[model samples]
Target: MLGNDLPPPTEVINMYKLNQIGLMRIYEPNHEALKALRGSGINVLVGVRNDELQQLASTESAAEDWVAAYIRPYWPQVNFRYIAVGNEVIPGEVARYVLPAMQNLHNAWSSGVLNSIEQIKVSTAVAMSVLGESYPPSAATFSQDTAAYMVPIARYLNSIGAPLLVNVYPYFTYVENPSDVSLPYALFASESAVVIDDGLSYYNLFDAMVDAVYASLEKAGAPQVRVVVSETGWPSGGNGNVTTPSTAQKYNSNLIRHVLSSHGTPRRLGKSVET
Candidate 1:
């Protein structure tokens, strides 16, 4: 769902009206929306905007006040499920804020005022760029620079029982090397046979990408951490060469079918993914 820079109250009422029409989830930074839609049944995922992270990290009191003022009052009324501390913090210019934002979020979560802290989850989303190399299946790994930052973050997330959220896009891989990367393979349909560790076979790119993340986590010594794909979708419209509607429909349809079929990965055969 799209959000705005508007203050909490206005955005909350606006979202409530939008929710009535079928937009169930909204991403926002304001707490007033939580209060406005209290008991309204709308799901909200709050964000810690980058600009505010410096302030939030500077002092524990700031984090406490922000949560108490924006989140505490709306408790039990608003369905606050996730607190995303930073967006794409791993591989971009905002890497500096990743640690601090995470620390502040933990402080806020530990504060007893929120009431729903145990039920609510705190996490950060990362872009696919965090992977240093993703091709050839086996060579895929996290960048040394990213690992320098992600290693400790992964440990902390594991310590808090938060899953590592990654945004993967096989479409970009196909677009970048369409000649070698088959569309069906990227779409999670056809079998593109490739053996990894000279034994395990890979049929689709999605699993390959996932396994790459799994490998990174293993290398980081946070092997038990669960990885979640926070975002993955085909664009419905784009330029003639890449974003044509026909290609979009084909990709999306195939993806939906694959997901609904409940086909587990080679590494996780017969084990259905719940989400």
Candidate 2:
């Protein structure tokens, strides 16, 4: 949906099935997409727009209504997996409403309307900027300003048996600090280990970024909570050499291979979670 020339919802769903894409995460409640997803069998992680956070946090009923309108109707047919309350709204003004939105949405979902199906959990999506210190992965911690919001949200997600959704963009990290962040590491094309953190090895920037979030969660007293990568990609042609087609294809293919492999990240080896 981010592109200017995307096909219609039906065509898009067909392509997903044809390509065997198991899961999808949308940025907002796209009714056309929801309708097309019914009986499609592709797992879905739907997002609530950042603007919707204030309304959802304002009242429990508002949350319930949102679920009713965007989720309930498509139920088991849509294979709803998770409801993201907000995307990258933290470290800013509306950060105050993120947890409240999650709480209200959780209450609405657990209010017996959708009690029969506990699989459709509620959480929020955030960017890597929430972490103040991310290098060395293990030593990562949330920034002072964002901690007030992330800490509570982490605990809430842990309590509800839901995973925190994070948008980890190694490409941006590489471009921002090309002098330090190498292209091979950012694309997961490195042959040898890159960073060694507390006996854990990291060969790619993606793992480092994700582990940083995990470290932040643990520091926030929510070590048990999981993380789902809500968004990640390499630009196709926006920039010059760094955003060429060759690099984009390599990054996308390597990412898929890395995720499908049996071995997970250094910090979470042998443990699997959705990407």
Candidate 3:
């Protein structure tokens, strides 16, 4: 989705079907992609553009219109799932608008023609920067600047029983400190437990990073809220000496196997993760 070189949406859907990848997340409503998703039976996580937050927050009508144009037409056939209100907007200029936009969108989704349709939960996607502390997962808390909005957003998601979408990138963390963060640990190739926090063992960076966000949610007074790792992947190439196709394949291969299992994480045992 990051480049124009990708296959047509129809072919992409076919590829997903052939590979049995049941879930797909598109950053925005690509009409053709949505059309292509019709009857594909692939549950989709769709996003609301960050720029559209202000307008959607301004009026419930805007959210309603948005649903009419984007969602109403192909819902059942498209298998619409989560609707991300904003992606990584917290701590940014429009951070203040996210919660309101989510509220409005949720209201619109719950009170219109779309209302009768099963819930398509509204939540925001956040990056690792939102965490104030991350080393010891149990000690993680939302950074001061982001907490003002993140806490409320977390609570709102809890109120609506929606899971928080997190973008977890061990690559960024590893690249920043390769010496401290071993490549095997970052890529989920660690053969032994690397860290122990609050008596919970962590074998890989992905779980640690995700557990950090979970801990932050606990402190945010939304401990009951679940987490959805909306995005997580390693670079296939580009970084000098660091990026390689084999490494990328290894990381993703292990990642998929891990998440697809019912083992979950040490923090949330037996609960399968939705990647």
Candidate 4:
């Protein structure tokens, strides 16, 4: 999903149908994939490349031009749900462009330049590194250095109806501290003992991680904003035993069931997530 190049449109369509995948996220707008997905009934989330953020953020005209060129051409035919301003670029060198680009894009969409704007939202994606302290879930808060940028982004997201997109990987956590983090806990094993934090029980790492973001939002005075898991997966190839097929299988399968069951994190009980 990160690359601009993709498989043939026909093959992609066939694969999506075969796998019953109703939604897809592409890192950048790949015309071939968009063409293939057109009228396929599959919802898509297209991205703005990090390098192009400066241009888009500089002026509303640039953002409008981008939408006109990349999105309007396939309007109605392609069900684009969100315009991902940037992917996992938060807290990096280009972090400054995240919010501005989102604002410009939102302005463009709301200007009625496009046929449909209500159906599309604007946001950026971030990784767990944005949090200074993620343990205990309740202790989570944006890092001091990044809070200046993150708080505004959160506020903007809350003002609009967009969710804070984040990419969480418990696999990386387990790999980094295998001695302390249990594999079963990371894999969502039903038999694993619940890790109690703030008197609430966390049955798996995914929920705990998600609750951390919620805690951060609450601290930032933007608790109303929702959090969406834009990306998550166990690696099939890596440096250690953490990349085994069986581990990937358990994590992905249980994750699907956990998310689909309408189970929200402890911080937001009964309120389903939009990941």
TM-score of each candidate? 0.79, 0.97, 0.97, 0.94
- Model 2, position 234, has a per-residue lDDT of 94
* lDDT of every model, 2 decimals: 0.69, 0.89, 0.92, 0.86
**Candidate of highest TM-score:** 3
> For model 4, how does the per-residue alpha-carbon lDDT over 1-275 read when each residue is reduced to its tens digit?
44677567779888988998887888889888888888888888888999999999899999989988888888789888888898878788888988999998888878664635667888888899899999989999999978988999999999998888898899888888888788888998947446788888898889999999999998998989888888998987665677878778888998888877777888888877666
- Model 1 steric clash pairs: 238-243
The candidate 2 region of ten consecutive residues with least summed lDDT is 265-274
Q: Which stretches of candidate 2 lie over 4 Å from their true place?
A: 2-5
> How big is the positional error of residue 152 in model 3, measured in Å on the Cα after superposition?
0.4
Model 2, 1-275: lDDT tens digits are 88788799999899999999989888898999999999999999998998888999999999999989988888888999998888888888898998998898888878685887688889888999999999989989999979889898999888989999999899989999999989999999999998888998899999899889999899999999888888999999989999999999999999998888867788889765468
Q: Which portions of model 1 miss their true places by more than 4 Å?
A: 1-27, 30-44, 136-138, 191-198, 260-262, 269-275
lDDT of 1 by residue, 97-149 (tens): 67766777677767575544666667777777888886554576789769878
Superior candidate under TM-score, 3 versus 4: 3
Which tens-of-lDDT digit does each residue in 173-215 have in candidate 3? 9999888999999999899999989899999999999899989
Off by over 4 Å in 4: 1-6, 113-115, 190-193
Candidate rank order under TM-score: 3, 2, 4, 1
lDDT (C-alpha) at residue 81 in model 2: 90
- Cα deviation at 41, candidate 3, in Å, is 0.2
